[model samples]
Target: MKRLFRILIIGLSTLALAACSQIATDANSLFVSELTEKEDAILSIASDKSFVFDFHIDSEYKEASVWIEKYEAGKLVDDRLAHLTTEVEQSGSIIVTLSENTNENNNSFNIGVGTDENLTSINVSDTDLIGLESMASVWGSTSEKVAIDNGEAVLANISYSDDENGMHSLTTDFFEDAAGHMNELEKYDVAYLLKVEFVK
Candidate 1:
């Protein structure tokens, strides 16, 4: 009888521990891609797609900053894609949207970042698009051109946790580039940082 009682207690303890472990994992879930260790890697996303990052900034953090950048040859080319700063605690999703050039009336791609109803935008003209196309030779990806020509987009998303080991989007396989080119991201320590890149 005592042996059976001990076995039941052990089983219950194991089940309780598993439930707690699952809760912790679900609470701290972040995006991690297979190419996370590679450098100068890009994620090819279709046009008209949006990447949404849900975040909650602790009040201990006085401020929050968000921005988007473009890289070539492991160097940052454009740093002003979308930028936002907030003084109060922000708890919402940071959305990055990519819109293709469908008509000659608007032969430009607009990269927009929004939190709820507030939004910030940047306009990339055809001339800028051509410049991006020329940089593709360095990556040696012919498909990159096809994607770019088809108005596809690429973004590097990075998230920083309390552990100080940041999490990055699947496409930004290059930890070196993400680490080196923080571009003022380090200034404002964010609990969760999502760096977006739009290529069209």
Candidate 2:
């Protein structure tokens, strides 16, 4: 009787652990699509300019790491950036600063990770600047597609327009998944920083 009770307890414990693992796997799978989008956008943007876009991966079952890719003329020009492992707390923020040689004026953009609480704003010197409007238009179109495909239900609350500074700002709360999950594993909010600065 004692042996039977011990075996039953062990079986129940194993089943419980397996169930928990399945739940985590399902939750993590929902985030895979979002992660793919980030990679596609980053690769596409990198192909156009010689710059680095750093990605911070966060996962409980796997080691977190950063993947960097460089691009120029719509192709990966080089792999100057290195991949680095990260901690769980530092997983959400993916900062991609343009190399100094790429942006001679030191003008750069910083995008937020999982929220629009901290957005990057461009600074345009002239009110009649054509480049600023063009940049805003390009970003608006690209971001709209990403937002819709991601099923960001609150996308209506997001807006992309120019500010009084002649600079363009894309502000929106459409950064989370359909289930209202924060999806911090993927940096969806960093889309704004993917814009390319044209050389004058």
**Index of the highest-lDDT prediction:** 1
Global Cα RMSD, each model: 18.9, 19.4
lDDT of 2 at 150: 22
lDDT of 2 by residue, 66-139 (tens): 33322222233333223333332211223332211222322222221221122121211111112222222113
lDDT of each: 0.32, 0.26
Error of 1 at 32 (Å): 9.9
Cα displacement (Å) at residue 188, model 1: 29
TM-score per model over all chains: 0.39, 0.24
State the displacement of the C-alpha of residue 106, model 1, in Å, after optimal TM-score superposition.
8.5
Clashing pairs in 1: 38-174, 154-197, 155-197
Would you list the clashing residue pairs of candidate 2? Answer: 46-71, 47-74
